[model samples]
Target: MIDMTTGNPGKLITRFALPLLLGNILQQTYNIVDSIVVGNFIGSEALAAVGNSGIIIFLLISMFAGIGMGAVILVSQFFGAKQEEKLRTAVDTIYIGMSVAALIITLCGIGAAEPFLRLMHTPEGATMEMSVTYVRTIFLGTAMSFGYNINASILQGIGDSKSPLLFLSIATVLNIVLDLLFVTVFDMGVFGVALATIIAQGTSFIFGAVYINRKIKIFRLFSHRMRFDSRILLQSFQIGLPAGIQNLLFCVGTIVLQRLVNSYGPAFMAGYSATNKIDMFVFMPILSFANAITTYVGQNVGAKNLDRVKEGVRSALIISVSTAIIMSILVTIFGRYLLMAFTQDAEVIKTGEEFIKRLMPGYFLLAIIFTLNSTVRGAGETFMPMLASFVSLLVARVPLAYLFNYIGGRYNIFWCYGAGWFAGSLIIVSYYLSGRWKNKAFRFVEEAEKPKR
Candidate 1:
């Protein structure tokens, strides 16, 4: 049996995080490949066009993924508690994913794709039409992204992280192959790049849906209704709503920051984008452990094994701290080479180097922050991470960026983002230490489910 409900904490965390790390690495292979193709083939401007859309990109994907997190939290708990019926009931959660918000965001995102690029002051020489192609293409594929996230989340919720990773690996390879073929053979540029990603993700969506249908033995899901169930919908929304909102708010804040990066022109845009890539490298392993903790914490909490949750958190802390230190050193030392991987432009390289040095120190704090938040959330403590991000992102980061950009030069923009990460980390640290989330329970989901009269 694939038991996520009980296990040794240290062994559990390692087992879970390793596959998660591999999954993340595979996922990133798409981006790294895209960057090299876009940078070398179309030029830095094309890279910036893609880079400039980071907010819209993150907003769309993260929003649904956030909802996925909700399912993970609830289903993990149910599975841990050995409540098979509740687990089956939760299958309806997919409806929360197919929302009006998805439509609204996609339309607005596609519509604003070009204008937003212009707002960033995209250099005419580099970004002409490329931004539009990149943003519009990504927005068009939101439905595929939605499906993939839902299917994958369902698998992850039951502690089958490797299952999602398996299909995702296939998709990642297809994406790269298509990216090279389109960009190289067809001479398609950004549009080719964008199309490749959508097709790849769409392919993954198909594979995941088919795989789950054949493998996961949920009755209502596989037999009863090919339609959305109110009970399942309610549970899905109950879990996904807050996470969705949090990611939306966070993405909005990133848009504010993206606008600031825009003002620096394409060279700076490329530099800062490279820095963002570096940040992801830092985020992956910590994220790996954090993701594990959610399952570890969620299942254990459901099984009423609070002791295991505590122990897993400790193991996560040691792993996270060590990884953070190592990544910071690697980033600090190889920052230039990494930047060079994206663009050979001397000006962009210099700017990327400068931006990275400023952000390196904060990686350690972020390592703790991400792990703690994920652990808490996995333990069913959503509010703290939500509250922490809300305050730090909207209240601190946005306003601070405005202030710094107005008074200081471009360097202040980088600092503004760093400061928000720093502040959010502190808030998360305080919240984790408080032990309040430990007392809270995920009652929203259970109450949301009702029988048809």
Candidate 2:
């Protein structure tokens, strides 16, 4: 594990972010492969179904993942502060809590799968059935999904980003192999795709658990009894709850947007889905930098080197924005070709190309917002970031989407994404400029330095 408390900010952030970027790209392949397989084999309707189900799965998973972010922040801070016991407790608490949450979510997701899809106004008949089948199968493996995410978060918190990349590489390759085998050979359609994802995710989680237990000396997962510290749990919730609520709200907004996509028919939906896979690739670098900054700021905050935190954010902004600009250009040039890889349908390809054109310009704005928010969150000031997201997604994007739809129909709805990013960047920039987050970081560091009972 690398320590960020002392290093050249640019190199450290880049070193940490590169592996994460590659891992996120690989992770996106799960969806890309699923889309390609289903769109080519089972047809556009099935592709739409998979895309619709993906949003709901994200909605469910993102809430808990936000809470998981709390554990990650605490882990980074504790490790930086050299509070070894606290770090171990934080890790154990998240594992136990997330495991239980995964079980509960799985049950609720399976029971409510059809109802949720129907509520989203998923197309009637085969689309609805396929969405329900795919979603429920995915939910059944929630434990595996949560398990892997928790492992990755903890490792990231401790400045070990590369290990998660290796884990994801295994899962991604396995997912592709299974996707082709089940969907192509077995002809299992949507069910085959979902099953492949679950099996691959489960393998990765099991492998991560074993690797961590055997190789990692700083903490033990299975070798010792796991402890539940209420203090750490409460602290994690305090830091994570607002972010969780923000994610929940964001997902709710996306569900509204998904309903808009649904009204456009299966072809548009398939196009939108394909674009989303490509979108993940474009945004992965931004996300990687954001995550890296979070850990960088967290470590510096814990070390009481507030200047380094600022320096890291600056370095991150330069790298991430430059990367985003290049990505926008590349996507503009090659997006059509990428869409062609998914399906031969001209309408679907047209719709996806339009999506790339409308949204590519806004990625730099998104990069700025994510970088600033992650910086604040790393310093244990999560509420502001949450508030910023709420304003951007719910207050701005969701409303503008409907308004644009009312004005110019489906074609204009994507404009709201840029508007939302602009709105969020304003909030985060203002907050960062105010410098209140530094006080928050100092308070957290003081707390960390206190003697444990």
Candidate 3:
């Protein structure tokens, strides 16, 4: 594992962020391939079905993964303090907590697939049917997906970003091949794409587990008790529950935005899905750097290196904003070509282009918000960012979306994107500049009296 506590802040952060950026880009690429294959092979209706299910899936996945992220903060802090025993306990507790949560969420998701689709206002017939099928298939594999994500979070917490990247690269290739085989060769339709994803996720989880077992003695899964520790469990929920709720808030706002989009029909749905995929790619680098800042700040905060932590945040901002500007230019220039890879339909292409033109330029604001939140999050100040997200999503974005739709109809929908970014960025920046996170950084338990596991 790379120790981020020392070394040049820019160089260390850049080195750490590159692998994460590549992995996220590959992940987004494979996701786009799912849409492309479904659109070309199964038809736009199938594409719409998958697209409509995206926010619901995000909401579930993010909620489960958020708790794991909290545990990760603990792991980073403990690891940075060189508290081996506490780090082990944190890992074990996270594994136990996340596994149970994943199982419960899977059951709930499978049982409520139809209701969720209906809630999203998915049209009846094939669109609704395929959506239900796709959601159920994906939900069935939540254990594997959550396992991979939680494990990855633990690795990231300790500054081992490369291994997850390697695992994700393997999984991305597997997912792409399976997507083509299932959809094109076997004609599995929407079910095929979902199955491909699950199998790939399971494979990645297995690989990550093996790596952790071999490389890190503390993460030995079978040797440790799967039972939760009361203190650790409570701490995990304290940090993670709010983060999960933050994710839910963002996704709920997304689902709300999607419902507005769905009212325009399948053509718009397909187009919006395509653009959203590209949007993820465009900001992947910024988000990756933001995450790197979290780990970087996390370890330094644990080590009580306040100066280094502050330096990391400043360096990350420069890197994130510059990268965002470059991406915006690239997307503006080559976006049409990217959209063409997804579909040949003229209407779909036009709608996607419009969405890109409307939203891509505002990514500079997104970079600022993401970087600042990640820094604060690493300092273990999760609640402030969570509240900021609620304000941005509930207080600012949702109402603006409805108002825009009322005033200008379909064309005005893009207005919500800019308003949300600006509001979230402003709120987070204000909090970060207030310097409260510095006080929240040091909460380390003394290593002398370690709890028995």
Candidate 4:
């Protein structure tokens, strides 16, 4: 784990963010590959089916994904304060709790799959059937998904991004091979897409487990010394619940928007899905810096180096905003090619081109939201950042999407994204400048001076 509290802010961020950026890129690429194989080999209807279930899966996953973010906050602080024992405890507790939680969530997800799709007014006939099948299959692998994310979060919490990067790299390549094998060779259809992802995620979890056993002496599974600790679990959820709620609410807003998108039919759904895959890559590099800042700020906050934390935030903004601007231009230029990479259908490509044009230009605006929110979340001041998501989704994005859909029709639905980004960024930036997060950040190190259990 790297000590981020002592380095030059720019260099520290760069060093920390590159691995995360590449890992995120690879993750998104594999996701894109799934769409490519599904869209090309299976058909646009299958692509829409996958897209139709995307928000539901995310909504379910967000229930515990936020806990991983919380783990990072606590783990980074413990590492920063040199509380090795507490750090290990936090890691072990998070893993155990998430494993159990994953099982519950999986059961809930599979049970709720059809109802959730029905509520979303998922397209009828093949689209609805495929969506249900894909989600149920993916839900079955929820434990593996949770395992990989929790372990990776533990790695990131201690400022070791490279281990997760290595594991993800292996999974990405394996996922592609499996995608082709299942979808093209075996003709398994949408179920193939879900199965490939599960296999890759399960493999990555195994790799992470092996690496931890070998390298992290403190993280052995089921060691008599490594029993569960309720306090650490509470601490993790305390910080993580807001993040989980934010993602849940954020997905809630997307589900709302998605229902509207569904109104436009399967063609638009396939188009939007294709563009969404490309969009993940677009924001990923900038968001990686945001994630890096979270670790940097978490360590600094724990060390009580508030000034250094401030400097790190500023440095991250500079790098992230610059990168966003560059990416915006590139996406505008090559948006068509990116869309074409997913599907060859003329209508899908044209619809995606329009969405990309409206959306990519505002990514620079969204960069501020990501960076500021990450900084605050790292400091354990997640409520306000969580509030920003509510504003972005409910107060701004969803309403705008519906209004546009009612008045201007299909294309104007894209404008809501830019509007939401601008509004959310403004709210988060105002909070950052108000300097309230400094007040909210708990002295985690001081509080946990005496390790529990």
Query: TM-score per candidate, in order?
Result: 0.91, 0.98, 0.97, 0.98
Model 3 scores what on Cα lDDT?
0.86
lDDT of 3 by residue, 49-140 (tens): 99899788888778767777778888888878888777887888888777788888898889988997898889899999999999999999
For lDDT, the strongest prediction is 2
Candidate 3 — worst ten consecutive residues by lDDT sum? 444-453
lDDT string, candidate 2, 314-390, tens digits:
99999999999999999999999999989999999999998899899998999999999999999988899998999
Candidate 1 lDDT by residue in tens digits, 347-412 = 889888988887787777777778888878876567778877887789877888889878887776
What lDDT score belongs to each candidate, Candidate 1 first?
0.77, 0.90, 0.86, 0.88
Ranking by TM-score: 2, 4, 3, 1
- How would the candidate models be sorted by lDDT, starting from the highest? 2, 4, 3, 1
Model 2 clash pairs? Answer: none
Q: Any idea what lDDT model 1 has?
A: 0.77
Alpha carbon lDDT of residue 89, candidate 1? 61
- Displacement of residue 221 (Cα, Å) in model 2 is 0.6
For model 3 the TM-score comes to 0.97
Better of 3 and 4 by lDDT: 4
